[model samples]
Target: MRGSLTTCVLFCLLSLGLSYPMMKGKPNDTSSKPFPLEDPTHNLTALADRCTDEGFDAMTLDDQGLIHLFRDGYSWSGFRGAAQFINETWNLTVSVDAAFRNHNKNQPQTHQRMYLLQGSDVWGFYEGHLLAGYPRPISQEFPGVPDNVDAAVECHAGECQTDSVIFFKGDTVYIYSPMDVPVVKQRHWAALGPCTAAFRWLERYYCFKGINFTRFDPVSGEVLSTRPLDTRDYFVSCPGRGHGHVARQNATLMSIKNRCSGRPFKAFSSDELGRTYVFRGGWYFRADSSKDGWHAWPLSHSWRNLQGEVDAAFSWENKMYFIQDSQVTIYRSNPAYTPVQGYPKPLQEELGVTEVDAAFICQSSDVLHIIKGNKLRSVDLKQSPRLPGQERPIAHTQVDSAMCNANGIYLFHGPSFYLYKDVEEMVTAAEPPEPGNIAATFLQCTE
Candidate 1:
C-alpha cells in the first residue's frame, strides 16, 4: 500500500511539471536556514500546496546514473522543497537508492550510492571516506547546512528520523551526522570483518556480512563493540566479507617517518587538493605521504581521453598538465582524479616543438615551462604558449629524471642531484661536456 501511494504521489509530481511548463523563476536560493529539525515535517503539507500545474521538468540523470530532480524549473534547491511535498502528502521518509556496476570484478560487491534529502540539503558518499566534493556540493560551503557531514555510502539515499543520515556503499552501511561534514558513527568499522551489506532501522546503523551483522552505537561510534547483531533482527543476506570471505584490504596508514616506494620519477606535480601526482610507466600514481606505498590512479583512458599513458603531469592554479613526448594536454578536475572535458591540445601549435621530455609550472611566474633535453620554452597559455625570452638551455648530465619546485629545478641521477640555479643561462651558455667528462662537472648535493 505504501509503495502504491509513493508511486501515485511521484506520478502526480511528475505530471504537474511535465504537463504545464512552470513560469520561469529565479534559481532557488540555497543559503536559507534549513527546516527546523524538531518539527521538520510539521508543515510539509504547505509545500505540497505550492506544487501546482505551474512547474518545470528539472529532472534529469547524470552520467553516474543518479536521477536528479531539481525543484521548480531548474537546479536542486534541496530535499526540503521536494521532501516537504512528499512527506506532507504522505508523511513518509524521503530517501533514494540506486545500484551501480562494480567496475572491478575483484571488488564484486553490489556497489551502490545513497542520496538523502532532509530539508534542502543532499549528502553523498563513496569508498570509505566522505566524497568531500563531488558531482555537487553537499557541505556547509554550499549553504543551507548547519552541521558537518563527512561521509555516506552507496544507495539512492535512505530516510533518517534521527539526527544522522544513513547511506550504503560496497559491503557496509554507514551512519553520518549532517553538518559541514558528516562524521561516520562507526569510525572503527575497519576493525570488523569485511562487510557485505548494511542498513538502518529507527536510529541505529547496522552492517552485515553473509549472516553476521554488527550494530554500531550512534552516540559512541562503536561497531559491534558491545554485542553481535543477528539476522533474526532483520531478513537480509550479506555479500560475505568480500568475495572469498577474506578480510577487507585497506590502505595502510603511514606516519610522517614512512616514505612512499616506486621512486625514480620521470615527471611530478601537485594538484589543488594537495595531492602530489607522479607519472611513471604510462601510469600516474600518488604516494600519500600520510600513507605507505603508492596508490595507482585512474586508468589512462580517464586521464585525458588519451590513447596512450600520460608521460608527465603537474597541477597549477586549478588545471593539470598531461605531457606525452612533445604533445601537451591540459586537464582540470573538480572532484580530484576525475578529469574535465576538452583537453589533449597539441603543444606544437603554440610552442612549435614536437618533442618535450618534461614540464613543470614555475611557481615564481605561475607559468608553464616545457623542457626538451637541455632546451627550455616558457609558454603563456592565456594567448597560446609564448616564449617571451630567448629559449634557455638546462645543465644536466641527462634530461630524463627531472623535477622542479619553488626553490629550483633538480635533475637527479639516483641520489646525485644536478641542480640548475639559472636554467636559462645553463641552457644557452653551457656547452655539451665530453661524453665521459660529464661525471666531473655534475654537482652532487652533499652535507
Candidate 2:
C-alpha cells in the first residue's frame, strides 16, 4: 500500500529555512542522534493522544511530491508528531523533529533536499530518516534569519521575477532570496492576521491560521477574496467536516491497452504548471517531475464540455486550446481551468485550419503549428484573423499528436514519439531519431 544535505559556509549568502540539512555538527550531542533507519511503528493513537486540534505546527512537501504535516512533540521521546498528506487525508505515519521545513522544487535536482528546523538547530532529512551528524546551528547556516520563526514557506509568485523563502514572525515577514540580502517587511493583510504556518501546493500559496487557512498572494501580500477554509476540513480527515476526502476518489488502475498502447488524442505541456497533459479516448494522463507518477482522470473531471476525445491541444498566451471535430475550445490555465466565454468556435474560424491531426506552439514563438496528414501549416497567433501560412511537408507521413516545450517538439505517432530539437528540425529532418515507445517514455510504463 503506502510508503513514504550539503555545506553551510558556501551557502551563507543563500536563502536559509531550506528543508535540506545544512552542516554536520558534533556527533556526540543528543540532538544529533541518528534518525531511525526504518519508519517508526505507525501508531495513529499516538497522534490522537497529542491531538488538541490546534492544527499543524508546520507543513512542507518533500522532493518526492509527498505533503508532510508536522505536529509538535517532545524530541527526546522520539515521538515527534508527523503525518503524510495522502488523498486529502492525514496518515499518522512519519515522525521528525522539525518546527518547520521548506522544500523548493525550483532548485537543481541535486540541491532539491529537505531540512528540519528545531529551535536554533537545523537537521537534514532524507527519505524517512534524518541524516547523521546534523543538528547544525542556525546562526552558522542561515546568518541573519531569526530562529524559531512563526512559519516558513518557499513560494514563487506569478508576477514576481524571483522565488523566495517567506519567514513569518509575529506581524513581520522576512523575504529571503539566494541572489540578494534578506528583506524585512510588515504584514499587510489584516483580515488573515499573522500566519501560524504557510505552504506551497500546485503553485498556490496557503497561509494557515490555527485550523483555518486563506489563499494569499506572496508577492502582493493580498489575501484572496474567498473566505478562510478550515485546514482540518481541507488538509486532514475529520468527522462532520465534509470538506476533505469526500470529493476525492481513489486512483483507478488502467488496463494494459489503455496505459500507453494506442495513438494519443493530444499532448501538450503547460509551462505555468510544469505538467504535461496526454489525452486519449475519454481519459487524460498527467505527468510531471513528481514521484506521484502518472494517473488517468476522466476528461470531464478537469475540462468541461467538448468531451469524448480531443483532436489536438496546445497552450498559448496563458490559455489552453482544445480542438475536436471542426470546433475549438479555449480555457484559462488556472486551477479551475475555466472555459473562456463564447468558445467552441469553428476550427477554421479560429486557427484558419479545417481539421488538425496534431498541433503545438513552442515557448519562444507565437506561431501555432498545425498538422494534418503530412502537411504542417504555421499560423502567426500575434496577427489578426490568424491566417495560416504556407503549408510545409513534415518528415512523418502522419502525426497522432504534437507537443512543444523548451527542449523542442515531440511528434507522437501511433504508440511511438519522435523528439525534434526544434520546429526547423521537425519539418526538415529527413530521418528523425528512432521513435521511442510512448508508454515507456511519457507514461513511465515498461514491460
Candidate 3:
C-alpha cells in the first residue's frame, strides 16, 4: 500500500509540472472580469444622472470642448459649421470645389484657379500667377519667349515690307515684331503672337488638358504642382465619383520615403495614376510578389498590376489585415511574394469569428479592431484562441439598425466629414451599457 501511494504521488507531481507551463502563459482571467472603476469622489449616481441630464446621449468630447449632438444621423457634429470644434482646437471652414474635372480616367485636367481665405487676405494662385485680388497692369510680359526672331518680313501688298519682322519657328511659331510699331494700337500687342506662345507653354505646364493634379496651399493659396496622372503612382479616391465604384480597393493618400534617408512624404508624380501609389508613414509595410510576399519596400514604391485586382492595401503592425467581401482576412505581411500565413487556417475555428463585416487598424495605436457583426472586438495577437460563442453576440452590432452597409464600418475620418469608420470609432469610444452599449464602451475605452 505504501508503494502504491508513492506511485500515485509521483503521477500527481508529473501532471502538475506539465500543467504549470500552460498556466504560466495564460492571461490573467481576472483581468477579463467586469470592473466598474469610476471616480470615487464623484457621486456615481449623480454622474449617471448627469449623463442623462447633460444630454449625455447627445454629448461627445474629444480632448476639446463639448461635442454637439445631431439628430439627423450619426455624423461628426459641427463638421462644416463655423463654431464646431474639430480634432480639438482650430475652427475650420473647409470648402471643396472641383479644382478640375477629368472627362476620361486616362486624362485629368486642372482648373488652375484656387481661392483660399484663412484669416484676412483672399489669396489667389491662378496658374502660377499668384495675386491678392485681380492685380493691374493685370498683364505681365510672358516669361518664356525667344529673345530674337530668325526672320522678320512685313507682308504688305503681298510683298516684303521695310518693317523688320522676326519669325523663328521651332515646334510652334515665335514671332518678334518691332515694339515701336503698333498694329492694334497697342505696344505689347506687337509681341502678341509671342505672348500667345508663352501662354501655350504655361498652359501645358500649369493646366494640361490631360489628367493633372493641382494642389493648393490652404494657407498660402499657392498652386503646388500640375502634372500628368502617373500610372505608376497612386491617388486618393473619396466616397464620391469613381471612388465608390472600386468597391474593395479605395486609394486614400500615397506617400513615399527617400531610400537613403528613409524620411517618408508625398512622392511627386506626373503619370496617369498620379501619386496614388504612395503609402503613408508608420504602421504600414509593402510586400512584393517576387519576394515570396515577405519583404519591406520604401513606402513610396510603385508597381503596375503587381497584384492584378489588388491596387493597394492598408495594414497595421506588419499584418495583412483588410476587409474583403465583408470578411476580415488577417494574413502575414509577406514582402517577398510568399504565401500569406495565419489565414484560411484553424484561426477561423479558434477565434469563433465566422464573419468580419469591417475592420480597421487604429492609426494612433496600431490596434486591430474588427466588427464581427453587431459587435466590435480586438483580436489578441498573443491569444491563439478566439472568444467563445457566447462572447460573439456581445462583440457585434445588430445588422438591421446599422447606419451604413456591412462595409460601413470602414468609413474615412476627415476633419469635416466622419465616414463610417469614424462613426464606428466614435460609437465604440462612447461607453454605455451592454449589448447595444458595446460601441459606446469602445468609445469610452478609446477616450
Best by TM-score: 2
Cα lDDT, all candidates: 0.37, 0.57, 0.23
Superposed by TM-score, candidate 1 places the C-alpha of residue 273 at a distance from the truth, in angstroms, of 2.2
The TM-score ranking, best first, is 2, 1, 3
Provide the clash count, candidate 2: 4
User: How many pairs collide in each candidate, listed in order?
Assistant: 33, 4, 59
lDDT of 3 by residue, 212-277 (tens): 222222112234333222100111111121111221132231111111122332111111111112
Please tell me which model should have the higher TM-score, number 1 or number 3: 1
**In candidate 1, residue 430 scores what lDDT?**
60
C-alpha lDDT of residue 250 in model 1: 19
Candidate 1 on 14-82: residue-level lDDT in tens? 111210011011122211111122323323244332222222122222223222232221222222233
List candidate 1 segments past 4 Å from native: 1-264, 290-293, 301-304, 307-309, 337-342, 385-388, 406-408, 413-447
Please give, for residues 1-447, the per-residue lDDT of candidate 2 as tens digits: 000000110111111211111111111111111122232443455433222356666656454444455554312111223333321232223332233334433555314456656566776556645566666786665566677666777755343446556777666776765444544444445555677777654444667776666667777668863566544333443333322121123222233114544445465554456668877766565655334222344566556654667778888877888888899899887645789999989998998879899998888679999999998999999989889989888888888888887667899877788999887887787876898888777655544
Worst 10 residues of 3 by lDDT: 1-10
lDDT at residue 220 of model 3 (Cα atoms): 22
Prediction 1 global C-alpha lDDT: 0.37
